[model samples]
Target chain A: MKKIAKMVCILVVSLVPTLGHGAFQAIGIIKSVEGEVYLISSSTEIQAVSNMKLISGDNIITGNDGSVGLIFKDDTVVSLGPNSQIEVQDFVFNPAEEKLSFAARLVRGTFSFITGQIAKLAPKKVKLTTPDATLGVRGTKFVVEVK
Target chain B: MNRSLRVLSFLILSSIVTVLTYSGCSKTTVVLLKDPEGKVGHLVVENEAGSVDITKENEATTIAGATSKPAAPKRYSEDKISSQFGEALNMLPTQPKHFILYFKSGSTELTDSSKAQIPDILKTIELRSSEDISVVGHTDTAGNSAYNMRLSQRRASVVRKLLIGEGVRADHIQSTSHGEANPLVKTADNVNEPKNRRVEVVVR
Candidate 1:
């Protein structure tokens, strides 16, 4: 029994550090909510995760059943409709110090996005990929729908 | 002398009459060809104010006062996907995988090391652009359920914000706060297990 307890303690101790390693910061907001869908992020760092601080490199997404919203650190707003999926592929800020590479994938459904400062500085740094095509934005308001 | 003078005058008169008749006949033929339907074609003249109409007969239609021809209709090209990328993307997981993003106790801030992992997540989504994504937020059993729910939402929102900033459309994400309802490690109340305090990302 003593040996079993000691082994169990060792296993728990080994796992603790790995568990605390990764977390996300909140950098945006949820602007509106519909029946089962929500429109989030209008501009800047209006929203962040409840317990986490949203930093420059975090990724935000919707929940199952197609619902949620996000506002980024740079007053950029994004709204997701039903049955949609997107990912934040990359991001970098501080143009004078470092450049950002922003990329996303639209798996399915519709999404509306507003441009931000980072997008304006280096438009080629940002890319939105769909199953059919990849959208290279140079500072513009656009809607992407993927089926 | 009188006969010679009369002959010369007659030749001159005939030659002049012949030339006049030939010129008149050529003019009529030219005019016939110019008037295809016997009604002049309407000339469309565009200016800054608007379009003006002028009727005239001509061999070719023309837009008067316009410097250039009308533009052709625009055509869109199809998306080109390489076969290799398509095959590789097909082998990826279809259902959303659960990834735990652990946070410090009582703090929602993501550390520098934690931020590094975001690129991998983004790359996975980019590689599998055909799949939908779902991110669920959860917390340890230390806090109140209501508070935890709100906290989980905050965590989800953080991910949502980061993804959008990275160019993900706002509509592609849905955030829900499980509020410690689904614990990964499942310890007693206020145990402070790092695994339980996390946000799970599942790509569908």
Candidate 2:
């Protein structure tokens, strides 16, 4: 009976589309791309294109003459200048369960960020990390340059 | 001999100044910028040594390393910011737009004024190269939550259909119902709020 119950539980879990949160879902969309921008995901790198869906753990790299812009599901706007790179470290914007967070790392380049609902809902949840220091955003727009 | 020594000392001092300037340029910099609406926000730069708070627009700070504190905040001129961040700024995407359309109490029918905004909404969508639209339905707190949920769903569907009829791609639109859970105006249970009974369409 216990084995049968375990099998039934597994079947029910598989039947549901979502597992209570937006896991493995596209968290943002690339709005614009100029020049030679590349997106690296799951160890595969491809040329970045406008309107491409972005998931967590993705890295965006721009060539010397490339630039890109993206908007998260929570309306957070981020843009990169030429020769810049950034990683989407963590993103969770499930307002229903009050799970709101945004984090990114700027490896080496110029980046502009505009906070969104996640920062408005929770001031301390948004963070941007650079090679030298970490930034705690308090609902604002800012730019960073890592030499 | 004394004159030659003085000239040698001067050369050493200028070289030291050049070295310091080069190191300063290598430090990472963070600059706060004004939003499109001209509002400024705050930022906190922290490291192992200490933290610096940036409150004013155009304020900036530099960090040398992970173990060093951020430099004191200093405001930058508009010209300097533009020169350094022009590429990033130009690449920024347009902010998402939102429109609220009110409904006739407890019904999916849109009010006269709300119905009139459909053309404007469609025009905005047409201007964008790629459109991702969302139509969410909401209701007042007058009825039971379960019934209100279904009503809100119907309201969203009605608006979605209208947009589709106006030549909007059906795939670009997504409809959802928040019921009485999310309200525009806070109200007691079983209270009627015309402002609360509405559908919000977001164009991105």
Chain A of model 2 scored by TM-score: 0.84
TM-score of model 2 (CA atoms): 0.84
Candidate 2 Cα misplacement greater than 4 A, ranges:
A1-22, B1-26
Best by DockQ: 2
lDDT score, candidate 2, position B29: 91
Model 2 share of native interface contacts: 0.66
Which CAPRI level is candidate 1? Answer: incorrect
The digit string of per-residue lDDT tens for model 2 on B83-160 reads 999899899987776788999988999999999999989988888664578788888999999999999899989999
Tell me the lDDT of candidate 2. 0.83
Number of the top-ranking candidate, with lDDT as the measure: 2
TM-score of 1: 0.33
lDDT of 1 by residue, A42-90 (tens): 2343332322233434334434444444444343445555555566655
Report how far off residue B95 is in candidate 2 (Å): 1.5
